[model samples]
Target: MPAYSDAPLPVGLDALVGMGMNRVKLAIAVALAEHGGCLSTPELIAALGEGVAGTTIARNLNELEDHGYVTGDVPRDERRRRRTHWTLNHANLHADLRALIQATTPSGEPPTVTG
Candidate 1:
């Protein structure tokens, strides 16, 4: 895939606060959005940073999956070892964010800022 920007999601971070999402979880989301809307555990770790432990990413990913934000599969590699390939559930994500925006806005209009 090609390189993509992650700007749209950072804008939703503040909105997600009402729903109890933290920056780390949102970071993982943004990274996945940037990476062609899909990335495995190792890919997410690399995109996040080497300093971030793999287990942490895995744990967060599992949580995201459970929360209906992301979904993926553990496919076996050529060596018969399993590896994860995560794909963003964009439909779910967009709908959730849209609901957030509509909830916070008047008449369900998205809030506009002059800055």
Candidate 2:
């Protein structure tokens, strides 16, 4: 994958899901990236703004962490309860983003010059 600009660009649904990232994971990844690459579980949920259940978000976060797309742990929260803090793996994210952009591009033969 090629290097892209710092800003997070638009990613097509087909392209995103086609790269082995499920809907929830894709949404989470994008949200994390937009949030400067670090966000707690609750922050991530609010970032997504999809109204998905916390359990669902946790499940997707676990899967994303396992895939090296994100990294963090269930550390003690403000009240001393364990909570997940996820951070996007920028390297993997950039690579996946490049692939996603490539997937959305229309590929075909070059136009012929008749002039």
Best by lDDT: 1
How many residue pairs of model 1 clash at the backbone? 0
Q: How many pairs in model 2 have backbone atoms within 3 A of each other, for residues 3 or more apart or on separate chains, i.e. clashes?
A: 0
The digit string of per-residue lDDT tens for model 1 on 45-90 reads 8899976777777777777776678877763233134578888877
Taken over the whole model, the C-alpha lDDT of each candidate is 0.70, 0.68
Q: Which residue pairs clash in candidate 1? A: none
In model 2, where do residues sit more than 4 Å from their true spots? 1-19, 75-80, 96-115
| Cα RMSD for predicted model 2 | 11.5
- lDDT, candidate 2, 22-94, per-residue tens: 7788788788888898898889888877678887987777666666678886632332355667888867666
Least accurate stretch of 10 residues (summed lDDT) in model 1?
Answer: 74-83
Model 1 residue 43 distance off true place after TM-score fit, in angstroms = 1.0
All candidates: CA RMSD (Å): 10.9, 11.5
